[model samples]
Target: MSTSETTTMTAPNPAAARIPKKTVKDFKFIKEIGSGSYSTVFLAIESGTNRELAIKAVSKELVTRTKKISQVFREKDILALLTDCSYAVKLYCTFQDERTLYFGLTYCPNGDLLQYITDAGHLEEEVVRFYAAEIIEALEQLHNRHIVHRDLKPENILLTDDMHIQLTDFGSGVIMDNNDSPPQSNGTKNVDEEKKPIKRTNSFVGTAQFVAPEILKRGAIHVGSDLWSLGCIIYQMTTGKHLFRGHHEYDIYNAVARVSYKLPDDFPPLITDLVQNLVRLEPSERLGSEETGGMEKLKSHAFFSQFSYDTKWGNLLNQRSPLETKVKLSSRPKLSNDELETMSSGFDDRVEARLIGLRMASDAPNGIDAIVTGSSNISLSNETSSLHETDNQSTLSDQSSTKSMYNSPSSNSSFNNNAPVIARRLQMPDHALSLSEQASKNVYHKFVQNNLIIKQGILDKKKGLFAKRRMFLITEGPAIFYVDPDAMELKGTISWTADLRIEQKDMKTFLIHVPGRTYYLTDPDQDANTWCKSLISIHYRYYNTDPNRKLSTTTSYSSSSSSSAMQTIVPVTEL
Candidate 1:
């Protein structure tokens, strides 16, 4: 997932300032637990305390290169601020070396919600309610602090040994001023209300699958966006599939804008209702939007009515986790010294120049526009648009820092007060530049399909023929497509093709025959032949016909209001 652009390098209060810091040598590394483009998480044991912890190591060079130093500082500050909140991942301390910065965090023995969901396929209603309630509590704590957890997803929700969930990863969070008067629940200002326009930050961040409509539109985001993500997590837990499954960035964006998914009929009405309300297309109408009492409405939602909304939720720490892992966490792949070096080198002079722009910019931008470009295994391109500019500034670069200016005893007031102005023009990072081309391939290859195809096609998953022209990506998991690239409506799989068969429709088009649906795709005759060949290869790789190949059977169905019918089958054969 992408990290946040908002910058807060120091804690906002004295209590937060008191969080201790330890040297990296104070902990003994156990093994790698998690990894992303910018950082790596490891299991470690504190030498003096003999306590287990998860230590996230981030490359200082890479951070400086990507111009995300503010995000790093922001995460540290937020974690410290939430140290006493049991619902969030606790920050034990922080440490840094010349090369890397380290964050000592509470180790969740049961892994992340994503792992649990993968193991269980779909969680039972009771279990979903349990986790969702805890997540709501966490959000409440954050919202009360005027912080928006911009990155909320299963991967960021960690599980304690006793099955309780903790919200982690604040790198993508936004911290607003709590001193400001609250906006009306309707999120609109009356003419009689304060004349000051409500502060709204515009940035494109967070994972594609879980982004909210407001975020996708490249508009301003608020607490409501987090509620939308919560809805997605709940739906994913209940169905073992992302509410918005897309082939790539464009597809995910489309789903975010449309809110086209439907809850399974078997889902309790309350659960279905909660998900729908939370993910409403209109931000103000969302369950916890500013127009609402923020987290209060979320807590009182029907889906969580049965769960107690209190600190730690009473005795959850002693309860057994709903999902269990058979293998030791240390079994995850470890990074080699050479791999680490390569990751560290991901940033260059251009990247550092961008960081300078972010740190020095004065006139704050209103919206973020992205142009993904890069060749490495990891990179994302992002650009900020100034409200004053008629034409978008080309090539994305991190925007100005929102350094918090506080008078806490430990505050570095001088640095915060006199922050530099970011440069007007900057280039996007390489990984960001390649997000469209690489992120899909990387995420799908590692977690979903080992192979996939990216191209234009029509998706008739729920609408039958004449569905809008779209881009289709066929992976091992599903045939994901996008009806509206920016809106992010994930047109789900229309058929399971055992094999791909192409029939010529005309000189400008060809028909692809899959298991249950035949798609007529338009392409020049020359390219049509290649498209057919590639589609066949992709399908064959997914459902290998090798005689020695093992067979697995699993029933699948969609709950979209347009297609509620179900089917069961046995035996594996040709499409």
Candidate 2:
């Protein structure tokens, strides 16, 4: 999954006095359990409480100077309202002192649902149903309060030692309505009569692989978006894959807009029906809440024929007792002496120069009007659109600066303050780029298909089409991991993926597909012309002697990286 963009929650200082620095040594920093773009979560013994808690340590200064403080607050707000489930990770309390915001909460010893599924390859029907039922119940609670958990995917759902689920991370959730009034946009103001309007909304918000179709298209949507995402997750759980895994972000959004699901022959009947209904193109056509068949109504469908929400899961809504609130941290995300200096020297000359150039230019080819040349909103003309569709993307590319500023309505002060991540204009990183690169690198290294190559010691059966992931143990090629491929209209298998991690070197990992009964020479590059010929000869000497056999591996190796690589040839060992 792409790391959800984090918003800094640092309170602004009246004067730009230097922020104080902190050493992790202050709190009994326990095991470094996990990390994301803006924070690190540790399994620690909170001095406040004698119990083990998960401390989500985010650099308040990092997110704020970068400008996502309001987004951080939104996460806190969403977590606070959802003190409803045993399956949802309980957020004990959120408080801040200076450098870090400490969230005192329960630690799931079992990690997340991905580990369980990766360990088992796919989920059993009962398990998938039970979990889905739990999620549906949770969705009902969230929707009742007018909150939308925009990002719903497997990794965000945690698993306890007993294997029950606990959903965490509300960073991407949006409160659709506040105080019975229409919710305000996040710092987005009404378009000026003089200025051109921006296109669709974009965010480092939701993880793309599991994002709902409606969310991607920026269409009229509500909590049902979560159900569509739920359908994606459910399909992955039962079939070991996503229902409509796309090759790119635009592709993912495109598929979501259509709401079409392609099921494989091996998929279960009940699962097929359930996912299809959940992923219906029109939000009202899908299951749960206000659709033609409401969630309570859906509980009675044949796919859920064996289930009875009233007799079974309905009891969850009636529970009243709260888990004893034990630990609350007044600790805020802090900066270190050196980090403060690095942050203060935070201006990106490259980004500044680029923005300056854009500001000075007068000509924008007529159709690219919706987007501010280099923003996440792609330019799509209502008509006369490009025949050959391509993703012309750009990014905000500064250290921690936000240059675009517009005023909000006088009383509309409720939106988050997340700073846009700086990205390069022409060469920004694509979504799910990690999957393509990893597929190219790992598959290329192994002369043949070898699961052992990926597993040396890190083998897992739980990670699925949408969730299984591991770090690079060797600093070799692009980090690679497997996600199950889904059936698509075009042809063959299609799949989705999480992001590639590069900050750490020991994280290098990869994948390959070798035909059985045929010993073949490895194609460092997945080139078609040369690879097609390589498929015919069994002798390595043939490859060594012929200059015609050479081809680039750049394309075929990584969907994102290898334009030079070739796909594995169809089996014809008899030749």
Candidate 3:
């Protein structure tokens, strides 16, 4: 281990779970290894055999707050299912505590491919092929299982003790079960239709830079999408930078949407051809798509055959990787004061503002919302308690039509006369309304949670009564507020995640603060008042149960799980 980096493994705490009493005391904590927003990876030792392994400890509360319940379940299932695949990571056992969940996994001592790439800046041709071949093999295994690995960056590719590659991180993966109707050769049909050559998904997920064109266009993706990401990784391996890097995340999205990127001029022709075949704009044009001979074309590519067409492909692992590809550990230097300040400042507010505007305008299917107000006719509400009982009577309804319920004057007139008198005349454009309704539908079923539409007040006093009527859905997360609802005129969008602070500024008004933005909302409309209170409630629930809040590190012991002990034993103890 590097001198500056400490590896930690926690000793099992008996009181953590209700399973076997003995399970908690089985593994001994050694040192802290790595940590993420919601989980920590530990380098632990099994007491029975004294064998070291890597275990991931994730907080249940954090997972729930992040709305990654499906991901958590999918990752666990994929790891367990792909244990036999040599190119995939192995999972031993899983156990959870009242505060955290644990997954015992094989330790990759040499670290990930990303670090090696950073150290070398770029890899040689032979080295890229070796890694690329292994990755292709890994993709083959995943594809055969009908699983699409939506995220495929170098960080998820770990190196074994011998420096061989093993794929990890299945959190963004999708498993194709019988429930989904496969897309037909001509096109996709409803879910009830018969199976076809491909499965189409509309989920907007995956790392921004590496996302495929199909994903950005229609939220539809197939197994071949992995090939597109693979092509990007191959390009990065040879050039040491992303093929589709833009000025910002949204720029990257636009680039992916158009497949507008150029490979290095110095790139080898054979390798270049291979990459081009994989990264075609249309899914069907990609090398591994059903129309393109799938894995056969990839395996038959000239680049892989450069080693020797007659040689058994798996035997390529026997050939030692280039000496330069080996990882060299170095101590991390302390950050300077200026660097510290920059790091602490989070994101640049100006850049974030622009990015948010672009995202809100382009991301949703309906494009952008149009807020058209007639004459100043209605007053805003200032007191939550003053909301009429009639406002509470209207329950949450589906947004199936383009016409917004906010424009109805009957709901807006109940506001206090002393409150700001903003015109209640609101008109949503057909495109924007349709998209918002679609977003609402997707959120309702995808999250498996009921979405409550509540009126939220705009806090900006400068905007006055002309501010757009904002929608709030506690379960949907990340409240998206429009500075201007019109698409063509002066307009922008500001969004806040569930993790931010939401404070009740007054009886009917609330304030939301994220890193670079602050939003205010006040509504005397019964529905708006109810929504504001709901926002306050949701904020407190998340804040009070902060997963990162320091918990009792000292564990209480009972007996350990015999099964857990037996499962963690490994042949190689260290990398």
Candidate 4:
């Protein structure tokens, strides 16, 4: 272990699950190892085995706790399956004791690659070659199993006790089977209709520091994404600087696509050549040149001419680094103390505001009520309070959709009374339908669960006080949904617009009458008040008065399409 750095393994409180009385609970409990959004890890000792290991205990209701529930399952399932693989963490066992799920695994006493980088400003060319070789070899093993460890960054690449590299987290890894859909490991449906040529996902769920250009560009990707990420790590090691550390997605993509970065003037030509190719915006033309060509070609490169894999890198890092990366980068984006404090304050305000709104919208009149009064005549009352509460808790706890909703300023809204009301209102532009949530969850009170559908031409805007509404056509993986977009406008007036389709039906659409209050109504019997909390009670912009531009342009909708300007929420895990 690195200078008194202790390690241990743990399981859920055995007593909670009636652990056998003689299981021998004598292992010493150490401090926490890692704390992430869904889990916390601790290092503990195994009294029986007299060995140390890392124990990860996750919430049993990880589904409710995590928005992307499949990801949690993916992590546990992949880790447990790959315990036999030398390049991956060795999972000891998986067990549950009531409210928590546990994983006992071998501990990495050397910490992660990030710790190594933190101790060294920049790796020597020879050192970089060694780590790079190990990482690619590890990735190859994972690919052989048809797994793509999508979230690859320094933090996830840990060094085992003997200094060999081990890939730790597989939360984002998707088992893309070219054959029939890999039997849905978790609760994730086959999305059979969504089956197509395995390609890169434009919508990302990984850290920006190591994301590929294809992901940034809203383009298709495959195993090649892994190579691109590896290139970023290579650059970080050599330069001791982040490759694409930008705030916005555009800046990140631009850097990856255009190589808008500066490197040391003496950077070896062979090293530069490899970096460029690995960071190539196109996957087919990425590094290694051929399937088995990665390590072979990399070995032959002139940059590694001084290296010998035999005894060359056995314990070079154990010898220690000269300086840390944070010290080497003088040009790193520096935030002043005052600036950090101000930014923190702003973030807290936004979070508080959002929490208040979410609590309200989810309260009295939210999804449950939306169904009862609108399309479905199902009633939610005393007899179904228990079911309603449980469903409400599930929706609030689900991490996928609402995280983006809370983070986004443009999408979330509240009503404002002082705002100028639209005086001469015409039909709302058909394009206003863009604001609706693309992933529609229809909570049928009678069914008392979530209905997953991509609703199309959903009733959006009510043409009048009581009229057929403007609806948006939304698509996800392989389904389509119709969403109604009736938002409040100037004071209490409903900005009325009619899609030619809704105009034909002429059905009376519903609207909340308060001037600037966006309340989630409970689907109660006609007697009770349903509004929970107020997310935003505001009128959507009526329309930009421009006759030259066509309103609601005929944009083709496809579930497979990746142009997600409107919210297509996906929860990103550290793994």
Among these predictions, the greatest lDDT belongs to: 1
Among these predictions, the greatest TM-score belongs to 1
TM-score of each: 0.55, 0.51, 0.52, 0.47
Better structure of 1 and 3 per TM-score: 1
Sort the predicted structures by lDDT, highest score first: 1, 3, 4, 2
lDDT string, candidate 4, 1-575, tens digits: 11111110122222223322221133333434553445656565555454666767565453343333445555655665565566788777555555556667778776677656645667877678778866777776676655667788877888764566788877766655534343232212234422422211213556656776655654443567788788889988888778774423334556766756666678778888878777776665676534426445645656656665443332444433323322332232334445433332211235335433433233324343332222222222221110011211211111233233334454223312122221221122321232222123222211111222222222223221111222222211111122222231111112222111110111111223211222122111111111111101001111111111122334443322222311122222211
Better of 1 and 2 by lDDT: 1
Encode model 1's per-residue lDDT on 164-193: one tens digit a residue: 789988887766543656544454333333
Q: What is the lDDT of candidate 3?
A: 0.52
RMSD of each: 22.2, 21.6, 21.0, 20.2
lDDT of 3 by residue, 6-100 (tens): 11012222222322222434665443444443565766666556556677777677566544554565576667567678888777767765766
- Candidate 2 lDDT tens digits, 1-575: 11323212243322212222333333344344555545657665543333566768666765655345556666766666666644566676555656667675668765666545554668777667777876787777777666777778777777554455677887777666445553232212233311211111244457555776656766554667787788888987887666675433445556666765578887888777888888776666777746454668667656656654453666533432111121121233444445433321111344224323442231122322311221111111121100111232111111211111112231332221121111101112442353244445443223212211111112111111111122211111111222211210111110111111001001111121121111111111111122222111111111111111222223133453222112211112210
Of candidate 4, the 10-residue stretch with the lowest lDDT total is 498-507
Give the CA lDDT, 0 to 100, for residue 312 in model 2.
66
Look at candidate 2 and tell me the lDDT of residue 127.
Answer: 69
lDDT of 3 at 430: 45
Clashes of each: 26, 59, 19, 57
Question: Which portions of model 2 show Cα errors greater than 4 Å?
Answer: 1-27, 180-204, 307-311, 315-575
